[model samples]
Target: MPLDTNRLEPVLPWLKFRGPDDRGIWSDRHIQLGHTRLAILDLSPLGHQPMSFQDGRYWITFNGEIYNYLELRAELVQAGYQFTSKSDTEVLLAAYAHWGTGCLEKLRGMFAFAIWDRKINQLFLARDRFGEKPLYYWIDQGTFYFASELKALLALLPHTPELDPIAVDLYFHYQYVPEPLTPLQGVRKLPAAHFMTLQLDSWKVDLSQYWSLAQIQPLEGNISELIRAELERAIDLSLRSDVPVGIALSGGLDSGTIVALAAPKYKKVLHAFSVGYPGSPPCDEREQARSLANQLGLPFHDVELHTEALVEFFPELMKALDDPIADIAAYGHFAVMRLAAEQGIKVMLSGVGGDELFWGYDWMIEAHHMTQQKQRQNSISAIATTLGKLAHIPIYEKFAVTPKLPKPVRSLLVQGLNAHLIDNEHPNQFVFYNLRQDFRSPWYHRRSLYSQEFLTQLPERNPFHPSVGNDAAWSDITTHLCQVLFNTWLVSNCLALGDRTSMASSLEVRLPLLDYKLAETVIGLQKQYPNEFRNKKAWLKQAVQDILPAEILNRPKRGFEPPYASWIQALLDRYKDSVVSGSLVQSSFLNRNYLVKLFQKPYNNYALVYRVLVLDTWLQNIR
Candidate 1:
């Protein structure tokens, strides 16, 4: 029943890169804690983890930065609290000492930390609002386990845990395991903006949320000015690091906005890093990135990846991302972080949350418009809408569109009819309005990829609902859509990919746009002016128009994507055997014959095949 120091051995090496500066362990009668230090602030022996305060009544092991630590520290000092070291870790402990769980609302940066309070004989855990940091925990035989990465958590288990079929189902449907669920049975990721407390005396665990984006009240101001001021302030706070910081630049507005504001304010020269392909494909944005870097008088660096390099890093990339994200663009993130690490830049800034917050995705916009039309239709008009679709039905082929409408538009119209008129489901949900005949739609609706046994294993739960109560008061449909994007795609895919890929090299990536305050402001702005989003990020463009280059402001949103055709074909050629006899088939979760047929025509089934291949490699690596 006593705490065991020996158990830490298995998970230590897996956590080495995440915190390579130092290692520390602490234990008492009931709980054991371990931490490996990255040492971003107060880089001295005083900054050691499992740090004690108030005569060892409170012991803490922490990860991530508190950008507003100085301000919080000054306020606590006024309240008769003192600190020995200038690290954010100490300030965090003091903040808890002063405010208890309410302290999470006061902190304004990314974090996932646990504090042991001997007075109450309890352990407390919390993650950041937007989930820029990672936290995973499991409980077995009355003992609780937690770590920043899934593999590290897996390493500490008594045995290799059973594969969670529900998690696997979500992965194939959503492309990543949604939080509060992992691929291993009995393990969970603490949902973001929430906290957990464990009481040893009674063995009781309680979880509660402290923040919700859907509930923020609208702020009053000229929307553009409010956004610009808050964005500038967020970037300024994110620059409060002792280590050298740089920006991951690209040809798009999101990264460009970061480079424009952050480069000038960063005390030292803020370098920009990017990734490109060998032949300068359309997806490559190195030239645009270099041009912006030149205009700003900042040094620019980029890595060129060939199909061979991508194929080589494919397995390693899956290992880097603890969850199977099914995103081929992950290599671009990993490549940029690796390049920055090589240049001795420990901290890098990324532009991850901008697109989701600003309605940048054309699909999201179209969904909103389609829903708006549905809301306005009466019974007769609804019938007329069906008739109109029928009028154009003859001209369109099976899953093909005419030349008059753009491809995206035609797809939207067809799916809109199916969702409302034909299928008669999901009248108000955009998450179900998928763009492709692939994994983008929910698992319940898909039939081609999943086997009958796997389908039977899935629970009758709506995966598209936000983890937070769906009935919470949202200002408008746009707000509802944004919240869904935040919960599903933004947290699960974009932020997860950014955090893991960057942390693979022990580098910290800060997304200033994801600052909770900025998020609340944007949510409020959306409520105050719902029509502004019809123009796709018009408020954001106006906010940074003067600071950014004219060309950068008006450019299209070609995100950091790969040359999919060549890359997928090459990857299929190299890792084909994985699907034929890999973990998916070995576990009886996939139909092997169906996968084999799909594998033969890689180009047609690229997205679904890419997902399955990643899952195969990930399962092998995990085992």
Candidate 2:
């Protein structure tokens, strides 16, 4: 029997969610596509999507917001495009009809949408420049499947997808699987700034690049002035919500910048949400966030997280996540979204793309320093000698500098040092190691699992090529960061977590920072601009200077990391049987003894622990 649309009903249970009170899944046979709405703009019946447009000539299931819709609508109206709705979706349809694929260039936002063009008998699929929104698809026997979440696609597909063991290895090294590959082998993520048009008759999917971050160019202006103008524009574009809009304010620079830019424009005290834990050092950014909120005169809410909350929410988190991502930050996001829904905020803005766009990550600095240092070496032999010494130090201790070395000397010594930072364990191997450690008496033997020939042949069998090659050190920061951000963090964690958590509450979250125009412009910048991003978003800080407080401007970028290590240790002590004795250890997927060793060591491997706990909880629930 052909797979009925009715059978796809249980695939996306969260799409039927309305407000906070009623959140669950539903199925429909008549509708070919299902949507899990975030409700970012025009929070009316008119704005509801998987929406029919232009006298039902076209229907769209869109996952992201178009920030410049109002401006585009004004242009369309002038060009004789009348509207039945005040939705960006309608505006997008009109733009598509008028300009075809060219419409993508005229619009600015982070988005992924599937448009059914009735006249053309085709399906149009697209993802934004930096891939802030995810679009995953699986094509089999002339039937094409797609969804904002990979799990949704998996739910609809007839066959159980095979695990990509190589991807499992990549996940261990990168913490998230790089794009174009999912945990499942058959499913694939659409690349950033690209689109595909599927012809129904022939069942052909033609992919093309609508935009590229490589096209960004350094603009000639005062560095601070340029930063201010572009950032303000980006914020203004993101603030295009028709429903009540709010910010996920953090002590970090990016979210602070967003709050500062948006607060003055908001009529009432803007509702800001944050998350933390009681008495956790790394988790407490509440005081700084509170200070900024006070300065801006916004109503701020901080939810103190508890271990029980994490345990209770673990299964839901796993279900929302398509793959077993090791990034523990997803839990923090899940907590925040729960709080956001409780406050009745339909759409919340996040500063997710700031680090990728503005060279905000320490990796960028380290990569740059490493590249420069390698250049200064007299010979390849000399460079090899330095790497040999660094390799002698334990991988875990690599980040720490000798205490006797002066700060400047230490910086110089570490500058331009490039090596594979993760302990040489491959991703699948690491998973196996972690699992084995969890099961046995917390003791495991290490062994070289794969032969050199086996390792060499792995990539050949893989569907998606690794974004950064084995030999590629981070020589080019701009391109490298763009690839890493899009392929790894944005796809694997940020958008994935946001989609799951927000949809669980029937809320939509929008990211303006990942807008195509903004991303392209930032990526195009000269490598030497704004003094090498030494301050990490130094230019962005200058751009929003007038709007942001001086104190906030100078603050370091503390990313959205909760105190998972401390919480996990506490959880382990209290619920040792639940975690350690669970199926996670028994499964052949991870090395359980290594996990025990990780826990035994007095270090912060909170992310690793959380991964095990989440997997443990998930396995327990499913079993």
Candidate 3:
């Protein structure tokens, strides 16, 4: 078997940002395999990939670092296996040689790889447990196409893919396209923690999960301490790299804890990178982020963003993300990764998974904790308003005349006292509800007018029933909330954002929190010790209290974001041309004239309007 250089030719342009260091292609009559190297570990000729085993029984073209490869390699050596290179690629090939698909369990790191078993004449493809890395594939006419990025797949495959209507509808509701469904037709994301074994003879596609977060084997005693130990072990494993590694530090507890733990394990001085916004209070985390980095004795890197800069980068950023995401914070993450790349760093650690796994989100945790007292108060308020009671006059006036109140008062009334009346209005509310309830017209204003076709078909499908962890029981609303947030928000949006942004600069971003072992432990602990988590991220705060100063460790969640609300007017004004000229609005499903009005509407509607802008820009760019 060999690689066809011609098939390799089309993906080179797409690979420029993914692997810029070295290029190689192997070709023969039956097969073509190509790899562009981003040399993190074993920066030598021997580490070159599409790497093959000694007996030529297995070959793999892999993306992502396997942190525990050294341990695996040592075990294989004891089993009398020989290696030619120090790269994890060789170790993975040996693991497959020794344990077969069992290798998936023993491996730890973010990855998406295809291993060709020469003896069996089959190709095995696998993605890491939580989807920290991405794999897209398209199969047509007996030939299979796969790539680390969707852009590469589109470039290499002959299919002129059309956008899937269902995916487009999901994109509007969820803000990012969900898994197993890419924005395009004929291409799909390989669901995480799963692998597919493919063969040419029968053309059978056998997809199976090797792991799940919900699978419970009761581990007794002090799960928090065990979780802490597992998290520390994951950090140790993630530090396995030949290149300089850094942290995407923020003032928040998650990244702060990561830096505190990782600094002690790393030998040389570690670096931390953070992004700040000029006028934005929440985005300006430099003051506190730098303070934590100083205490940890790590070198710190920082960049400041402004509205003008975000405006300029909008179109390019949308184009880079193969599908559009309504996450404004994604640009902030991209900026920090680009900062790392400019400094010649190849790998960085991030704190994305801590929220979903450990109950860091306040609204999500409070969804079940809402008091009977609070619900009664809300109902009383509603009835009073309906009957024109004098006591409810102030509330009725506030609700009826939503125009004149200052920003702060309106926010309090809508988010706090009026929450149950509104069902779910906050972004965090979307974490608990299914797609239909989550996308209700009152909150997501555009939900009422989605293309008639999608609206007709939407009720037949449930977006929350993800393929990976659907077996997890949802009878306990708390457990259901955690799974929903983890699957949809953590995996599809946050993790995907980190992967694309970091890889765009040829850097690897590792999230120790996403390690399958850690996730399973957290889920187990959530089941047994659900009471301890009543307070937001209390379990995690206790775990790291010894390592970090209380001042830094106890800080409430501060999002790393530019002032999206303040900058929304400018952002929309800048992209108005893109919206009017964009195909999504031009189509019968959506009115361009109506979309223009939404974008040009009054203040305080930034979140909804920017989502429209993101979708419009992405549709135009992908076309």
lDDT of each: 0.81, 0.64, 0.74
Candidate 1 lDDT score at position 496: 92
- Model 3 weakest 10-residue run by lDDT: 422-431
Off by over 4 Å in 2: 1-5, 12-14, 17-31, 36-40, 280-283, 375-378, 382-483, 525-535, 571-587, 591-609, 612-623
TM-score of 1: 0.92
Report the C-alpha lDDT of model 2 over 483-581, residue by residue, as the tens digit.
655655666667667666666666777776776656655654544363554447877776777777777788777766777665567656555556655
Which residue segments of model 3 deviate by more than 4 Å?
Answer: 1-5, 279-282, 369-431, 434-472, 475-477
lDDT of 1 at 84: 99
- The most accurate candidate by TM-score is 1
Q: Give one digit per residue, the lDDT tens place, for model 1 in 495-527.
A: 999999988999999999898889899888777
Model 3 per-residue lDDT tens digits across residues 1-623: 25455878768778878888887776534566778889988999998877888666777889888999999999999999998889998998889888989999999887899988767678899998888888999887778888887778878766558767778777766778878788788899899889999986678899999876556554556866987999899999989889989999887888988899999999977899998877547558898889989988888999888878888998888877766778888888899999998987888998888878777766565554542222234244453333333212334434633767676655544443334432322212322433233333213344444555445655454333232223234234455566567667787889888888888888989998888777777767767766654457777888888998888766778758667776678887777777765777565446555565666657445655677788778777766
lDDT preference between candidates 2 and 3, better one = 3
Error of 2 at 503 (Å): 3.0
TM-score of every candidate? 0.92, 0.81, 0.87
Residue 532 of model 1: what lDDT? 59
